[model samples]
Structure formats: C-alpha cells, structure tokens
Target: MNRTNSSKSIRLLNYIEEKGNKLPHPVTIFILFTFIVIVLSHILYVMGTSVTFEGVNNETMETEMLTVEAVSLLVPEGIAYMFSNVVSNFTSFVALGPVLVAMLGVGVAEKSGYISALMTNTVTKAPKRFVTPIVVLMGVLSNVAASVGYVVLVPLGAIIFLGFNRHPLAGLSAAFAGVAGGYSANLVLGTNDPLLSGISTEAAKILDAGYVVNPTDNWFYMFASTFLIVILGTLITDKLIEPKLGKFVPTEPMGNQNNEVSAIEKKGLFWANISILLTILAIAILVVPENGPLRGEGGSIITSPFMSSIIFLMMVIFLIPGVVYGVVTKTVKNDKDIANLMTSSLETMAGFIVLIFFAAQFVALFNYTNLGTIIAVKGADLLQAIQLDGVLLLVALIIITTIINIFIAADSAKWAIMAPVFVPMFMQMGIAPEVTQVAYRIGDASTNIVSPLMPFFPLVVAFAQRYGKQNGVGTVISLMLPYSIMFLVCWTIFFVIWYLLGIPVGPGTNLNY
Candidate 1:
C-alpha cells in the first residue's frame, strides 16, 4: 500500500511538471493576464457598483444597474476614471528606469570577462570545500547588479562546485539559495526597494492620510538580514546539503585549474584595492565634518547629498577598479574599449526591458480595476475580525506569501499585488510598513531556490546536466529542498526573535506603528 501511494504521488508530480513545461512563457502569460484584468475592470466599472474601497461602508448601498449589459458587466465609476488615466500612471514607466541603468553598468562588468575572470580566479584560490559557501555569498552580493546574479552566479556555482571534489548540484543549490532566496536582504538598496516603497506608500494613504513610507524604510533591517542570510546559508550548505550527497565521485577527471594571481594580476588587484580605499576616504572627508559640502544642515546620512547618490557611488567603486584592473592586465586597450563595455552592458538588458514592459502594463491594469484596493480593504477587515496578534499575523502573512510564491514565481509581481493590501492593513494594526515589507521579503525569497517556475531554474538544471544528463527540474528541486526548508525555518525564527526584541529593522524604521 505504501509503495502504491508513493507511485501515485510520483506520477502526479510528473504530470504537473509536464504540463507546466508546456505552458506559455512567463512574459506572455503576464501580457495575457494583464489584458484580461483590464477588460474585466472596464466591464465592472460601466455597471453601478462601489468598486472604490475607500467609500465602501455598511451604510453605502451599491445600486444594481438593472440593464442586462450593466448587470452582466458590473462596472464601477472609479474604475472607469482609473482606466481613463492609464497614460498618466507614472508608476508604469518610472519603475523600470533604475533597473535599466543598474543593469547597463552590470552588463559591462559581465560582458568584458570581468565577472567570469573574478569568479574563476576566486574559485581556484579557495579550498575545494569553501567554494560552495563563497559562491553563495557572491550570489547574495550580486543583488547589487540587479538580475545579474541569476544570469551569472547561478551557473557559476555549479561549475565552481564541480571544480572541487563536491557534487555540482549541491553547489548550484547553495548559489541559488543566496541569489534568489536571500534576494531581499541586500546591504544596499536597489531598484526593488523604491518600487515596493511606492506601493506601500499608496496603500498606507488609505489608513493614514499623510503617511509616506520612504524608499529606504527597510534598509537597516535588510543590512542586518544580509549577515543573517550569509551565516544561515553557510551553515546549511556545510552541515546538511553536502552530507546528503555521500561519496559521490565526479564523472570527469578533475582538471588542474590554476586561478592564482600572478605578479601582474596581484599588483593590479593591489592598486585596485588602494583606489577603492582612496575613493572611500575622499567621500568620508567630504561627508564626515560638520558643514561639509555633501552633508545636509542636519549632518545626518539620511539628509546628506552623498547618501542620495549612493548607487552612482557604487558604480564608480566597481567601474574605477574594473578599469584599473583592465588597464594593468592589458584587457582594456583604450577609451573606446571602455565605451564598448558600458554599451555592451545596456545591450544585455534587452530581456529585462521586455519583461518590465509587460510587468508595467499589468500593474497599471490591476490599479485601474481598483481590485487591489478593494482586496486590501477587505483583507484588512477580515484580519481585524479575527483579532489575531502581531506575531501570529506575521506568521500567517509569511505562510500566505510562501504559498503564493510557489505558483506566481516572480518576486516583483507578487509583491506588487500583495503590498497594496498588506501594507495598509498592518499600518492600521500598529505595525510599520517596513516590518510588513521585511516579512513579505523573507517569504518571497525563501522559496525561490526550490520553485521550478523561477526563470533561472532551467538554467541551473542545464548546469547540473553538464555532469549528469539525468539532472532535471525534479533533481534540482530535490537537491535544493533542504536549503529551502532550512532557510524558511531558520530565517523566520530570526525574524521572530528580532521582532520580540523590538529592534529597528531599518534606519529610522521601527517594528511598531
């Protein structure tokens, strides 16, 4: 009986995988869903219904438009207004701009062989056992470059792991865990931080008329999360993941790959390090003293001009050193090469450009329908009705988000859908949007390594296939199951502890309202 049940479960899983693989590309699916949402919203708007959440109270009696077209359509007035202003929604275009710029710089770093060379050299120098954790950490840090971590680091993890005497799939799992599972825990704010903040601000306005959630609201929490993720990720890889693949020898003879820094490379790296240090010193000198040019009148980092342009500073930090390395190593011949490198970076952002276009349209349509607002309001009412406490509420949210992540896959899209509802609800219940955002982030990130729908999941499969052709989605998922489960458990525990201690998650951010 047990064998029969196991066989049935395996067959069901196989059927699901087969169907999912045959489905439309995620970008296409987004476009189709956006169109459906827009059409339904417009139809509902034409009918007499109280689609606007703000005006929906018990005293409000929604008129039933008796006409067949109106009754069938169920359109609301505010939705029509929203549909009319589709072109005016700045959120659609503005959200994608930073990602484009960040990706451009990253493309240069990747296409010019800088990323590959750095990874190869690092792996060669490190001991075989340390490669997995280092790759995971690198994947976590690569969030600075936007989606480059998925494109570059995930595959490299498998390769670097194979270079050692370990299971390459385990290496891929570690990297994916860091890159996707810990995506929201970057030390520095990225394009996502602002986008989510904007959504939260809009949501919060429903409850607190003048409330504004800053883009950097969760920065401090995320900074601490970076360390938490690193330590947890390292422990999982070393203790659980590596041990499971017992005594598996590599199919191919290990190549004597030399990644050592030669005298010239060492000298170039030294100068690069010095240049970065000098750059930091210059910035410190400008900002540290009272009445310094970069400092605001308040002499606070939040109010300072230097802090405002931190991303550009990051670009300079990476670009200057990369250039110095290129010149010293003779990889970059002239200014023309530098221009080409930057331009090349922009070129590789084509996929992101396409994805963002659809994503923008979908978000705009969701807003136009007023469905997001109504859902948020209703959800808030239901949670209040239940009268759950803060900790339970957070746990419930994490569970809901994790389940949604399994099917939805896209972090930005899921957050865009969820933030409008939860942010305001939590704020009204005496919780900060930053706290809610952190919870959402943890849930969204923890499942990415195990979710087959993630865009990079197939790529990781291919990387694993290099060693064993039998490696597929199931294989990768099975390998990563431990990391995903451990991350979800340990990371949630850490968040609960942090909440209990009443530690500020970010700068000028609090756990409570």
Candidate 2:
C-alpha cells in the first residue's frame, strides 16, 4: 500500500508499457498473425504434420480416431476459397451481431443520461461509512451498460470522496478496482456475456459439433463474484489504500463541484426504475408459466426461446428504461431524439466494428486451416501426460491469461486468439468450455486496473491528477496494485473452491463436459 512497496513495481510496469507500445497495433497484430498462420500451414503441410485423436463423428454419433492434417492456405484452392469466403466470414462472425445489437440498447441508456443518473444516485446517496462498498458495487453494476463506469462513476468516486474530506485517490482506486478488476462480474448480463459466449460456442463446436455455449453459461459464478469483489475492493481501499495516502488537506475548497442529484434528474431516475420493473414483469409473464410461449420442451427455460432471445431481451431492458428516463427529463422530446441517440451510440462502435472485421478474418482463417484442432489435441495430450488436468489446469490458465492481459489489452482480441486453442483443448480433458471461458474472464479482469495498455488507464490517470498535480500513472497504479493482487489471488481461490464443490457454473452448465 505504501510507495516503497509499489515504487519499484511501477518502474517495471512502465518499462513493460514502453515495450508493449513499441509493438504493432492490435489490428496489425491480428493481420500479422493471419500471415503467420498461412505460412505455418504451408510448412507444416509440407512437413506432413498431423494429429490423430479420438473424436466423435457428429453425424454418425460414433467415437472414431480422426487424423487432422494441416491445411495450407498458400495453395491455389486455398487462395480461391479465402477470396470467396472473406465477406461471409466477417458477416457471420459469431460475436459481431449480438454485441452490436446489445450495444444499440446500451447506447440509448447512456445517451439518454439514464446510466449517468443511476450511478450518481447510487454513489452520492450512500452513508459515509458505507461509501466504499457502495462505490465498488455501483462500479460492478455499471458494466451492465458497457464502459459507462469509466467515464462517469470513476471521476464521480473521486469527487464524492473529496466532498467527504477523504483522499480522492482512494475512492478512485476503489471504483477502478470494481469497474476494471471486476470487469466480468455482474448481477445483470452485459454486452460482454453474449460476445464472449458466442466466441466460446464457436470454439466448442470444433470439438463437439452439437455443442452450444449460452451467454448465461457463467452467470451463476459471475453473480457470486460481484459480492466477492465488492467486499475485497472495499477492504483494500479503506484498510490499505486510503491509510497509505494519509489525510487530505484541500488547498482550495471545491465550491462548485456539485454531487447532489437535481430534482428533475431524481424524477427521471424514479421513473426509470419503474420502467425497468415493468419490462422485467412483462418478460417474466412470457417466461415463468409452465406452458409459456418462451419456454422450451418440458418447460425448460435454458433451452427455450427466452434463452435464445437474451440479446433482444437485454436490448429491450435497457432501451425501455432509457427512453422513459429521457422522456421524463425532456432529453428525448420525440422519436427523432431517440433515433438520433441510437445513431450516436452506434458511432462509438465504429472502431469496434473495424477491429472485429480483422479479428474475424484471423479466426476464420485459423479455423479454415484445421490448425486449432491439431493444436488442441496435441496440447491436451501433453497436459494429460503431465497429469495437469482438473483444478491445476484451470489455475494455470488463469495465470497465463493474467500475464497475457497486461500486454494485450483488448479482451475480444485476446479471446479470439486464445479460445480456439484453449477451449477445445480443455474440452478434450473433460473440462467444459463454460469453465474455460470463466477462467479467461477472471484472468482478464484482475490485472486491468494496473495494465497501462488498457485504453482507459491513461484516462484514469487524468482523473487522479485532477486532485493532486503529483498524481500520475505510477500513483494510480500504486494505489490500485493491492486491489489487483488481492482480487487475482482470492478470486482464483474462490473459483478453485467452487470447482471442487461441483457447483454448476450457470443454469445448465456443469464443470465437466
């Protein structure tokens, strides 16, 4: 918590950041990787590289030994196929459509100021003694709408702390810890759930053709983790981070820094809550009955129309509340305002769309080569030979993902590369893809606050400097390091225990395949 403990680590992280900065952009990295796969495919093909594994013949429902050979994309037929499938590959990308649709609803909520009002109400109204927990909890929930916490709640945390006569850095760290460190934990499903699950489903199909990984596959564990993160974040902030910074003495009292919610905003927030309740009630009516239309055969919600339509449901959930809030506050006067707000939200996604275009090609080409299956079978054989199955295997993956996350900040890009290899490999070891996906998420989130390569890291540094000129990247990282370490350690342990207990990770997902 002290400067001495973290000062040296900050220097090392800065050096790591420098090296990471020197690397190509994420899009370039994927493009270069695509070329690497192409080259490797040819060489391996020429060298007669292949793996014989016991796999199910999905059509026949029989277990058979299959020889998966390296397919060369450098060949004439390969080139022709690539040219023909390029557009389809991008368009049919599993993660693309669902994420965009979810974002459309999230866009309305954010643009209508509903998300902002909710966060302000949650933080500013908390009792001082309970402020740390409340801020951290709000940060965890803010992920429901995507990146809203970073822009709104983080600075709000600092301002709330300053108003309470506490060190602003401590408050900022707490919020950052929850927003980034608990990135994958949420009571309500976010855009990331479907985005990741879609990718995971594709990866699983490589091994089992009929396998389907739902967006809610990791919901149970993630819901439990929300509370775990709040408790841990609060303790680290109040006990370690805040005390280390000592007391704050404001040179100039921030007079005009208003933290109170205006009367109109409060009214908008009240109606927004009502709207959310009505939406949920409507959905429940369609989903809860024994013979409900949304229910699947045998009244199963997991395999029902409701489950498959989660993205649409999510869109409606946020969109309705957002529109209602905007109407009450006069932010949305008519249909034109709503349409314009949705367009603006899509504007923020232009960069993500570009990234997904390249990433999709990379994944599609990798699958086309059959390299993913070969790698998975070979890796599984090695791990099984070394007796690294079960909990240790999951633990090792979490650590590896944590380290990789520091250098590669984009979660989707990292998962795109990793899932093809790891998901099927673990499936071969009798571990489910849902478990593998959750492991990746935990590792990805734990180091987010400390990773300088994260897009929001510098923005958070700016938030810190607003309170004290001396506050920089090091100051922010130092303040956050304890929370990161504790989250990584405790969360991994919690997952291990959860795994050992044979708890179902989500509605229909067991730890084993």
Write model 1 residue lDDT over 1-513, tens digit each, in one string: 012213553455456556656667658877787667767655655554443233212233332221211122124654565456545554345445555555555555555555556655565577765666678777787776667777767767766666675666667778888888888888777656765665666555444535566667888778888887878888877787777765556566546533445777766666766777887788888888987888876777765677565556666766776777767777788998888888877776666566666666666556545555555556667778998888888988898998777667777667766776687667656788788988998888888877767777888788777766666766666666666777788889888898999988877677887
Which residue pairs does candidate 2 place in steric collision?
A: none
Residues 25-139, candidate 2, lDDT per residue (tens digit)?
8899899999999999899889989998888777886778877889999899889877999899899988999988998889999999999998998889889999999999999
What are the lDDT scores of the predictions, listed in order?
0.68, 0.90
| Model 2 regions more than 4 Å off | 1-6, 251-255
Those runs of model 1 whose alpha carbons end farther than 4 Å from true positions after fitting are 1-16, 22-94, 119-123, 127-132, 150-152, 155-164, 190-195, 198-215, 252-267, 365-370
Task: Supply every candidate's count of residue pairs whose N, Cα or C atoms clash at under 3 angstroms.
Answer: 10, 0
Per-residue lDDT value at 66 in model 2: 78
On lDDT, the leading prediction is 2
